[model samples]
Target: MSNVLPRAAALAAAALLATTGALVGATQSSALPMAPTCRVADLELAVGGPQRAGGAIDYPILFTNTTGHNCALRGYPGVSVTDARHRQIGTSAIRTGEPISTVLVAPDETVTAVMRTNSRSVAPNCRPKSTYVKVYPPNSGVAEEISYALRVCGMFEISPVEAAD
Candidate 1:
């Protein structure tokens, strides 16, 4: 019945409770399901206004989750130039130095991948103009036709999908 015994017991009980909580949290999170890969049909693609800097044009391509559920996007989105008829004009885009990782996209949330190309002002022929840009979301065979009239210059460097912010 001493005060020392009661204090020691209380501390031990607190420690046990904390340890139990940590284990329970870990187990529950491990049991949680992960989002499936994003399908091209469920994503809405949009291109932001182009910004020119350092003789390079960076196009921010946005992929928004149009569905109510969550999905994931990993790696670089295949980007290529196209004409009015949706013909691929050049080789697929080369991956830039951006680290490739999976991005969990919530419903109505947007992720972005920046396409960088040499500015037409630097060399018109080197950066031929394209009437449209065909973007294939990571791991998607189907492509989306986005109105991207620009001098994309044969699929320039592009980064992997990341948070739009």
Candidate 2:
């Protein structure tokens, strides 16, 4: 009985150690991998608007490529809007696949992404939402890139529905 007890304890300890090792190995292997050699630098966001009916909100995002190696920005950079209470109210998927839309920024050049929101409605929720833009490396999901806020506000001002006739 005494020998059996020692053997059982040893087996349990070995099982525990093996389990722990597996867990650690899994965690280390499944980490959110580091970004590719490319990165976003000098990211800036500016919002302009409050124009009349059918006008547009000009949300120009500017950023520089500080890295020595050239990098390409693909598609329209993702833009997200947050309200006064810091709640994300809306998202603008404004990347049009226009020619020259996504291009490589050389070592020190600047890249600009212009996003336009059509002011076709004046719904309160869509009325001048305080917003910011975050740029991610091309094809990198929204989760990967750090966000940078715009200095200005986005006012999607449209005449009331009745006025649109």
Candidate 3:
């Protein structure tokens, strides 16, 4: 009976230590630094219905540049679509206007840019897939953007979804 008490106490202590260690690991993994604010502005992406390959779909990108200083509308950040295996199957780029002009969104200005997806190039089947949208400096990686990065990060369906549906 005397020996049993010491053994049970040691087991309890070990169990407590294991629990604490797991909690610490979880906290550390969840700590991601927040994105820095380049200006007081908000930007969003809206995708219309999906069209088949070699077809066209209207995509509207909306942004409100609210800072007093004018900001340059460089280019598309980075757009990608991944398959079930998490492999990147499609990469998208921003197609600017004919003259490829730079947008200078003045303070408190709201802007909307409309672009058509080159379905043949970006999406073939136009099926539902995971899409990521990012906004960064022109000719820069999404991760390299010091200011902010916008990522959709999940299921995004191209217009029509399917011809049957």
Candidate 4:
């Protein structure tokens, strides 16, 4: 009976130490600062070229971080073709790429993604040119408007943001 009591006491002490260690670990992790997400106000977007290939026209969507601190971008930017009045003219861009991986942008750094639009042959009804391309950075509610000449039949796709090299 004496030996049994000591063994049980030891087991109880071990469990208490494990619980305390787990709590300390959780606390440390929670206290670490999380990276900030990129916002439209912190970015300057540029749309490059009509690199035509096959039945599609591709453009490089470049995002520059103009903020003073580092920020992260993940997934795809919300893209839409907008008319002069800023109303959506066609379907928003659908994401295309491998699973989302976070891309960190330092001050004055740039990141890029591809924006693809189908040719008129594929989307014959894609008439009524768009006057602006509205872009929303990933994980941000704010949007930036960029003036561009994009004709759409409601078909648009955007690849996930990645490090620009």
Question: lDDT of each model, Cα atoms only?
Answer: 0.83, 0.45, 0.41, 0.83
* Candidate with more favorable, higher TM-score: 3 or 4: 4
lDDT of 1 by residue, 1-165 (tens): 589998998888778778764333356434334789999889999888988787788999999999999999989999988878877777767999778888889999999999988776764666446788889999898888899786764338889999887
Q: Give the alpha carbon lDDT tens digit for every residue of 107-150 in model 4.
A: 99999888888898877877588899888888888888899988
lDDT string, candidate 3, 1-165, tens digits: 999999998887778778754332346434333333333133323333333434444454445555555555544434444444544544554344333334555556555444345443454544343433333333344322112122222223221111111
Error of 3 at 127 (Å): 5.0
For each candidate in turn, the TM-score is 0.76, 0.46, 0.39, 0.74
- The TM-score-based order of candidates, best leading, equals 1, 4, 2, 3
Cα RMSD to native, each candidate?
Answer: 6.4, 15.3, 18.1, 6.9
In model 4, state the lDDT of residue 144: 85
Ranking by lDDT: 1, 4, 2, 3
Candidate closer to the true structure by TM-score (higher is better), 1 or 2: 1
Give stretches of model 4 more than 4 Å off.
Answer: 1-34
| lDDT comparing candidate 1 with the true structure | 0.83
Candidate 4 clashing pairs, residues 3+ apart or interchain: 126-153
